[model samples]
Target: MANIEQAATYYEVKKAEDVSRLISKYAGQGKTNKVIWLALIGVFIDAYDLTTLSFGIEQVITEFSLSPVMTGVVASAIICGTIAGNILGGWLTDKIGRYRVFMADMVLFVIAAIVAGLAPNVWVLIIARFIMGISVGIDLPVAMSYLTEFSRFNGRSNKAARLAAWCPMWYAASSVCFAVVLFLYFLLPEEYANWLWRVSLIFGAVPALLIIFIRGKYLTESPIWLANQGNLKEAVKILNESYNIPALTKIEYAQAVQIKPSHTGFAVLFNKTYLPRMIVSIVIHISVAFQYTTIAFFLPSILSRFFHTDTLTTISTTLGLNLLFAFTGGLLGVYIASRLTSRLVLIAGFAIQFLALLSLSLIGQPENSFLLYIAIIMLGLWLFAEGFGPGAQMMIYPTMAYPASIRGVGVGFNRAVSGVAQATALFLLPIWMAKYNTHVFLIISVFAIVPILVIGFLIKFEPTAVDVDAVVENDNIIKNLQHQISSQ
Candidate 1:
């Protein structure tokens, strides 16, 4: 054992590092990137399937004779279901296994997509979308955990930096959804327009189904998670497959021996160590979801209303701008996140959102063509901040906010908070926008920003990739808990 330990130390100093130490080091390299890349497909599906409805919703409303309220419900149905999925799926991932959640969620996605594609009525479509939301809810926390863990294995200090892949992928998926809508709209005859929306909605299943097939071969248990379960052998295999590192020490397994293998309920979040993080995660996610979902999903319709443009022009411009600015925003968020603190990035993002919303309220219905151009410019700036800040960070923050012990639960809770915000936003946005004008609606969005700004500045901590144990020395809350545990 002594000789083996010495050899491991030698390898760490010069040759292949031990698997445990190097997991975060090799992120986005050979096998680690492959796993993360596969995991991102789940995020892509979630973003695409969930956001596509907004682009095609005008068509759905026309087809089903949906009132604004009904449209809101239909729009938010998946989010509502996702709220449940996030809670349940996170628990299951923490309790059962990551791979199991991955497999099960996609199956739900496939079935839900089929129902959505063939729905005979609005209620059926709502039910189908709700089911789809559940799948997304389950898929995200698990997939995000995989992505973060592998990226940490790549050896990046701040784990949130790895999430750069997440935002761009999300924007790309939304862009694809719009592109599909535009394609089907043009290809099909005027009489068959409803099919355009249906086909575009169902397109979510394709990538999901393909990724599902890949899970058995490419996907495996998260080594970080397995180590948590005290399964050294299985964890070692996964670590080797992920980064091609040598066998690891029994550090994780030995420590985990003391951990009870059961669900740590919501009560865990209330402990001194986790409380602030939980608060930050929940607030940032909800605020971002409310702002983005309401804005991004309704942009086309809002444009149609604002400029009084024809349907074709509105749809074309909507898709084009969402692609251009949103894609840019995603990239910016990633770049900024890698360099800046999360709190700083988040503050900047919300500030931009607030300014943009305030500007739109003030500019209400440009009197001339010049002001119209200005409104468009303001809209672009708002989106750019969104992509650079919340749009990108929402995914990153959830993964970073909690330790591996309850990552799934932590992220799921974030997702659940997001779902509540999403459902309320989706349900109320259209009705309120229609009731008051777009001007009032834009101003109302400012409300989400104030709280986010207050919270972002108060929380001074950031998440590192390793684990909670690694974080305890710096945080008084975690330190106190550690002291308590030792005393006990």
Candidate 2:
């Protein structure tokens, strides 16, 4: 009996090894390029739709006779809805699966786009935008989590960054939309102005339609999620199909031991083991959220106020900068993120943004075009820093830090909080910019400072090149070592 039990244990351990080897062998092949591309395209479409409204604001305001306050409310509605969507989508994805949730969200996005385009009044438009926001909001966190989980660590991180890199397509598409709006504005007589804006809103549906086909045909569910659910057979099958490996038998599947789920919750984030990292992530996200809304969404309005450029020029320049310069920032961030720790990159990025904002606040005054130009360039650089640094930081950190069981929830909570911060900033920044002007930069400067302090002093866990799972284990070892040293 003892001999039989010992043989059984040996067989189980060997089986687990064989299964791991088989999975890694296929994962090593890195054949997920096409899937990653399709996912990136999906993200691009979502980003484009979300950002397009910023460009359409002038048109919407003109046609609807909307006050600045009303415009802010309209913009804020989508963001608020997105917060709810993130939580709901995350829960659904964890409960159901990533592919199912993604497909459903795509349909929602398309329907919302139609409603928004056809909205007859401001109230209707606001409701449609809110729904649209929810759809995209759910899409971002889930899509990102799917990409990270499906990707193998070898060059997969870079590929994941590229998935986000395509986010500029959002700005590029918005730029084109701006161009189209400009053309229609000129081509059509004054009587058709309202129709022109409505057309642009309707046109937002194009990306969604394209993505629906792409996602339906190609998107694969996350194998990690499958493994965590104890569906080794399905997980292995996906690996075989995605990475082109030989099929495994039920016997092989039974040999694999179950992976215990990580106990992830909102409360877990505040636990002693995780609190510091959580704080750092929150501060970085908040700073990025605040700056992104102020710069990306509000910059054109601010530029128009300061430069007194024509509507076309303002829109064109805004589109151009976002597509060209902002995209550059995203790429630059990926490159930098590969070279350094996410925390370090985040720290440096925020530090640069702080200086840039301080310089702008000091020199940015009415009638100072030269300083304004400098400020714009610096602002782009600031965006580049965040785009390259904290952007990757947040995406990689949460995905890696949390356990498989609560990974979706952890990401959802982070996104929800970030969304709230962004929504508040989006609604208020414009009003503040119109009213406070220089004081706005001052406020941004203060927010930027918070992350630098958090990273430098408080953050103890640094997962630079470590696998996210390994990072959690290593963090435990570090804690034990610290305790021993202190006691000694």
Candidate 3:
């Protein structure tokens, strides 16, 4: 009986090692690319839902006869929900498991999208959008967690930084929406043009529903999460079967034993090791959320007001520049991410934005027609700059900054901060755009970049700094050493 029990223990540990090896192997072969693509689908939906209103704000306000304050509410509804979703989903993902959250949570998004598209009034639109926001919040952290845990860390191309793909994908989603809206602008008759916003909004539900369908069939929980929970049996099964790898034996069991079991709670984020990273994460997100929300979210409206452009030109132009600059900047980020520290990349990104905003503010409204062209160029510079630094890097930071134990919570918290910043910006922006001087907001935007730059300097994100497995192993070894010394 003793021998049998020992053998059983050996088998479980060996199974765990096989799981670990496959996870690493999958990372190297990019077998996990399917999961990454799935994650991008979620992000694309979020971005489309998020910035879609930027183009349709005028139409909504006109059709509904909404006040500036009411318009702000309409603009901010999804962001407000995102704040709540991030908090709730983050906690739930950590408390439950990534697989459940990843697969099931899209139901909320599906519902939210449909409700938002069919909203009958301003009140209904606000409420529907807020509900949709909740789904976005829930999905982002878990998706990012899945990416971070599954990605290979062989160091040639840091898997961690690929998380930056979120922004470009986000920009891509926005661009797609813009293109469709432009096409429909020509497709729909003038009498029915007012209904374009409704069509654009309802269209979001189609892809959203498609993601849920595909996820139901293929999505798996992160193996790291299973290992942390001490569910090595299922963990190994996913590695061998889902990931299509083989089980291992004695030598592999040693490595499998090194992974620590997971404990769900928010306590780990406050640990000294992660605390600074947390601060940096929150500050940069807050800054990004606040400033970017103000500048980018209303691009169509902003350009329309400044240059006195027609609706088609504004919508087409906003997404065009967003795609062009954001894509270029994203590639730049990906290329330099391995060579430069995250800090320097962030500073470089922010510096351009500050100068761009400063230039825009100093110029005041583009008085001459040619200067309006220059305004567009400056806008391109700011958007492009963001792609390389803050915009791309922000999504990657939260998951890697915390150990796997509290990653969901860490990401949720970071996004919640973003939600607040975005919500505040969304809420205040229309009011400001309506009543306040443009220069004031422009100055505020430039100043906002300062604290983020400060935080960037304070952080030095080590590629291996927060490896959950390594972190736990080192702690256990240290404790064992201290125990021996004290006992002697």
Candidate 4:
């Protein structure tokens, strides 16, 4: 009886391994556009939703008669919601299945967007923003997982490159948001200016609805994730359906006693195998989030303060920087993803950001036209560096570093930390700028410096072209580790 049970286990494990290899072998050979769009459209929605309100927050404050503290709460409500969403989303994604979580979050976005657009009071608006934020937070982990699992390990269009594309999608979405606001600004009567923010926010639901409608056609449970979950039959079916792979799951005689039936929780991320990756991923993401939240989110305000610009100039300048510098930089990052290591690219990005911030500090509130121009250039340079470097690396690192079994949790935890940094920066930057002037640049420079020192000098690990998931999730490796542990 014991031998029969062991033989059955052996067959199951071998069949699962066959499914995994089949998916990896055929990953790059299929119709990839649907999968790519399905994963990335969420990122576009995230950036669009966040930016829609940026140009209209002053009006929201006036409409609601909000105090400073209440104003901060209203502004940051979404970010705070994301922190909780990241933790819970990642866990549920891994605990259940990717497709379920993916579809559910979009529903959340649609509902939240509509409610937010219709909210009549400050408290109601805050609740709506918070719910929308949870949707954003939940989408990221599953999105990154899809990007990583659906692509091959190395190529011009590898997993890293696909992940890099998210940064540009983000900036492109921001640019579109600004363009829409600018159009509405001119289209509306002076008496109806307050409706601009409400209308723009409701616009966010369009993409979410489209995604939800078409997602069933393109989105499928990740084959790699399925194989890991002991569902080889279904895993093989998805590979055949999504990847156009003619494959079969076959169980043969294998060492069944080596099978370790267990579950991986969040604590597994801190084991010796993953702690270093955890550190690197957390540091890179938090640093990028802080700097981006402080600068990109407040670009209009920052421009007005530094150059004493008018509303039109500030708006135009913000749109230009995002489209020209930030969006272009993201394209540059994607172009170089196949050519360079992610670590090297990250270090170079942080170095440029540090110098740009330092330059802005020395230049200090440009007094003349030439100095103001230089300051604006510095600002563009900072955003460009961000697009090409840490912005992409943050997604690339966690998605690639951890295996599929725990990829969601690892990426989720990393983003949650980043959300904390973002929330903190969002709350503090306005206060700091008012009190410290240009010295705030110096404080911001510290974020850039931390990544430069950590990734450049301390960590030697890089995820580019490396199959971290393949190695750690290998059945033979797991069997060997369990054997060693049992002998002890």
Model 1, 153-182: lDDT tens per residue?
223423575575688788788888888888
TM-score of each: 0.89, 0.86, 0.89, 0.91
lDDT score, candidate 2, position 395: 66
- lDDT tens per residue, model 2, 1-488: 01123223121212223333343223544456666665565576566666767766767888789887898888888888888887887677676777788778878988988899899888999999899888877887677766665555444355235434543544455566667677777887887766766777777778677777777455777666665566666666666777665545475554554654545345666777566656666676787788878777776676777557777777667766766676766767666655566667777878887887887787666466676678778767766665666655666666556654566666777778888998899888878888887668888888889878877787756644554532333577878999999999
Off by over 4 Å in 2: 1-31, 156-190, 246-252, 255-265, 366-369, 469-488
Predicted model with the maximum lDDT: 4
Write down the TM-score for model 3: 0.89
Per-candidate clashes come to: 13, 1, 2, 0
The total number of steric clashes, by the backbone 3 Å criterion, in model 4 comes to 0
Q: Against the true structure, candidate 1 has what lDDT? A: 0.74
In the range 1-488, model 3's lDDT, one tens digit per residue, is 01123223232335333344345434634246677778778888888888778788888999999888888888888898999999888988877888788767677777777777778888888898888898899989888887777676546445556677777788888888888788889999999998778788878877778877787556778877776665666676666555554542344454555545454566677877678878787877887886677667878877888668888788878877987897678777777765676677777787888888887777768889778888888888888988888888787678776656678999998899889888888887777777765674574565457655555555655433445543543676777899999999
Off by over 4 Å in 3: 1-31, 249-263, 446-448, 456-466, 475-488
Over the stretch 1-488, how does candidate 4's per-residue lDDT look in tens digits?
A: 11123223232225444554444444766655588888899999888888877777767878999766676787788888889889988998887878899899999999999999889998999999999889888999998988878887776678898899999999999998888788888999999989888988998999889988987777888877777777766776777777877655554422222333433478888988789988998889888887897679878778877678986787789999999899999999999987899999999999999999999999988889999999999999998998999886779999888878788898889889888888787778777877888888888999999987888878777877557655664656777899999999
The residue pairs that clash in candidate 4, if any, are none
Residue 337 CA displacement from its true place in model 3, Å: 2.6
